[model samples]
Target: MEKARRAMFFLLLLIADFSVAQDTAGEADEFHVGVILDLGSLVGKVARTSVLLAAQDFYTVHRNYSTKLVLHVVDSAGSDVQAASAAIELLESYKVQAIIGPQKSSEAVFISNIGNVTQVPIISFTATSPSLTYNSMPYFVRATLDDSTQVKSIAALVQACGWREVVAVYEDTDYGRGILPYLTDALQEIDVRVPYRSAIPSSATNETIMQELGVLIAMQTRVFIVHMSSIMASLIFTKAKEVGMMNKGFAWITTNGVANIIDSLNPSVIEAMEGVLGVRCHVPRSQELDNLSIRWNRMYQQDNPYESPFNKLSIVGLWGYDTIWAIAHAAEKVGISSARDKQPWPTKSSTCLESMVISTNGPELLSVIVQNKFRGLSGEFDLTDRQQLKVSVFQIINVVERGWREIGFWTVNGLLRKLKRDYSKKTGQASMLDLNPVIWPGESTEIPMGWEIPRVGKKLRVGVCSSEFTEFIKTYKDPITNATTASGLSIDIFEEAVKRLHRPLSYEYLEFDTADAPISGSYNDFVYQVYLQKYEIAVADITIRSNRSLYVDFTAPYTESGVGMIVPVKENVNTDMWLFLKPLSTEMWFGSIVCFLYTGVVVWLLEHLIGNEHVHVPFSLKQLAITIFSIFEES
Candidate 1:
């Protein structure tokens, strides 16, 4: 009986093994997804980890699904050519249906072109240059918000703070240049002028950054908008602090690139970036997100045991996490494996000349992905018509002593109070009062005037034109005191205008004249001096003409609009017969004589007809006219 039971058990095990083999063969369909990233970069590392974790989590939830997602990640090594090469290899060799990444905007440009030719979707979470739009490359989808969308928010901040002039300090790469036109347009809409643009190269040294900082410090504009990666921004602020440019009068603002990475920075880096304001994507807190955060930290720590814990996840990582799910859901929605196999995958030799390998299911998968909408780690997962994230809310944070603090929220409508539950349900205005009080540079609570005249070291070199007419502008030297003084109408007007400024200004009056008496240059030459930067500004009786205005800017004229003519009035000395008729024309004199005769006849006729006792029948017509005239004079 025992031998018979053992034989039955072996038979049952053999039958179960055969059934499991058949089941595994039936579910052999694997969807190959490729990832192109610079794994050496901070953002790239986070992205790679996020995507790996997402795939793990996705399979765990949908273990019974028909197809499984197999990720084939390739390191681009932070080079554009390497990124493109990696993408081509994945498409031709691995037959990947979708690609995520090539973190930089420049890298994405080349890789996205390859994706278009291959009919594959190139989804990028951090390549935010506005130039990478879906209009040109239909297969390119921006999983993250475009950098252009945030320019309006930055402009609103500048407008709300009453900054009349702003200077943009950004990297010289495509990531920096792409958003400049949009930023300028937005600022122009709010009547703010971008006086200067300081473009620093990505590989610029400390000395170069300091040189740029020095140039900005000497400028009159104190409000600066810094748009660059976190590393470069840290260097800039460090140099700014060293030069005393990050003091009370200075204002610094950054974009999402630097802002989103603040939590992961070292304390020393954070210290260098103290009092900097930044705009970051607002990710609403949720239970699922919290759970994911915990799981991600554990997995990340286990994977990278030597590195420190990040403690916080950026939107870039969150977008990566959600992108994998989006692709998975889209792939599962179209359950036909024949759809992916219908189009022939090209070989290395076949695509050597053209590099074209069309994916049969690319369009359908993209359609489903575009249509897919759900609450994701980075808020709502919806793509706009432009194939970019449909996010509107952005948080304005201030870098303080203990990491960053949320000061306010900015949306398409305007700025709002600190974001909370159901915050999107309410609308708000772009007013400073709506936001929490910000501790600006120098740890001051007061709002900066946004401009300052260097108090300690530098003085404005004001150019004053020496005039032949001393009444307009007179410069004299005291014989004994050896002191220079300037006085006159022009000087008074300049002083009064300076007094009316929002803040105090220190200026030294520099008379632009030879050792001789009066200035020799024309008004046009005098104004050109300002353009050449020989002097900060010129104060004189400078006539504003169209030609002069083309070379340099001019303030509203302090004097009258046009020239005034002054002439003496002569006494009237006419001794002719027609002199009496000078006041009344000759026609008027003739008409008055005829009117008297007609009035006399009419008065005599009326007196006879009415039979007035005062005017007897024997009364002459002239006498009746005189009586009528006397009555007219009295009444």
Candidate 2:
């Protein structure tokens, strides 16, 4: 009797468990998914909470529809191997419709493989490693940025701070290693010179760091860029402080860098880390986050309830959260139905969901991707190309006193214009270039690095105007005799400059003849005589005006004297009248026009001629200019 009673209870228990399992399995025809993640790390945990909360909100608001969402969670403990195992199990065994959250690069790489095999869509929250989509995983997508998007920004910040020589210390893994090539390409494209880089192993020691630091110090490295863990950053900062370098002032630029380690920091640590500048691609201040912070603080008493204690770790983490929300919102746009009571929810496999992807790769899909603009929680997001983020936004932030202050925002065109080539093409002013080409801010590579040693040669004879107020260097007789050698400040500068360019230099005293020689004719003779490889180049303190740029290329000018008056500085002189009135000065301006038209014809005629100096100097046709200038004025 007792055995029969026990059997009856066991049978009822089995029946109840079977009914519950049946409901969950049969409900799957409505979209279901698996979220694979670490759930332990601060970034992972925050991402997990946001997605779950969002999905809950998405489903509850759409209950009028028959659609249902069931999400299964899988913990990988931040291991790629485990993440892959879990992802495969979801695709093959449980057969989820799609997946989200392979929060780091290593796992994302392997999980991408499962998406390929099963043809289920997968999107990642924070895997920025390059070559992401090429894992034979056409079905995969990333909800985060590519590795190189803000590398130029990071390099710019470093260059802006005038940290010319840097030492790179990166983690050995894919996340850390991925930064290597892309950041290097960015640095190189900007022509920045990096002296040393160290690829550190995961098991790096204080001794290894010390050895590398010693090598860097030997090379005179003053800045350190730590591109690894917070653990690594804290350790290096502590070591730097111990080495007395931090206190004595060494620049610390962290890549994905940090200002202070909040949870791990003490009063002394904050003081030690004060001067460190971390390079981050800052997000524009979002009204959504501002509002969220207000509500979250009132309820949870935290800056970011969904974020870690390092709440403002970077705008990157917030952007990641926004990426997931953006995908959901875009899904709503395309999957939405007009009938409120009979709408269909977006399945993870829905064709409507596929149409709105802004990052779908392939030559054909580029136009479609560009057409969609997503409104994310943080801000709007779009893609201009496969690897490029089209958002024209960023800021340089200086973190201080438990908050951040804006250093400035980087507008796309504004920054480019700042770095646009220094030539006068864009500035519309030749006068500016003639005066100053490279602005040496009391500091610059005044002499380029590794300046080439000059070749020894016979002294190069160069000529300049000898008029007292001009660039002409005078010659002096030896005490009693009437022979001469070169002597003047301009002469010295030209001589030294030629040697700087590895050319020989000699000087010829050009005493201007009493007669006014036709300038177009005389210049032809000067080029044939002075510039015929006899002297490699000339620096005559001559006003290039305009005609010279056509006949000969001028090295950046050495000196420019504004039109001067022999009258005393104290005297009242109508120099304005003298400027256009002096026949010699007017010729200097007008002959420039004559030479332009005449030189081209002369150059073309002389090109293939075989005679010694076959090109005849063209006489200045004053009739041509007298006609045009008068016509231009009248018109």
Name the candidate that leads on TM-score.
1
TM-score of each: 0.78, 0.52
Extract clashing residue pairs from model 2. Answer: 254-257, 460-505, 460-506
Name the weakest run of 10 consecutive residues (lDDT summed) in model 2: 445-454
Candidate 1 per-residue C-alpha lDDT over 241-354 given as tens digits, one digit per residue, 9 for 90 to 100: 899977788899999888888887767777877788999888887898899888888887776677657535788899999889988888788655745564544565644524
Clashes of each: 0, 3
**What local lDDT does model 1 show for residue 528?**
86
Q: Estimate every model's Cα lDDT from 0 to 1.
A: 0.81, 0.53
lDDT of 2 by residue, 167-227 (tens): 6777777877788788877777656666778777767799987775555544445566667
RMSD of 2: 21.4
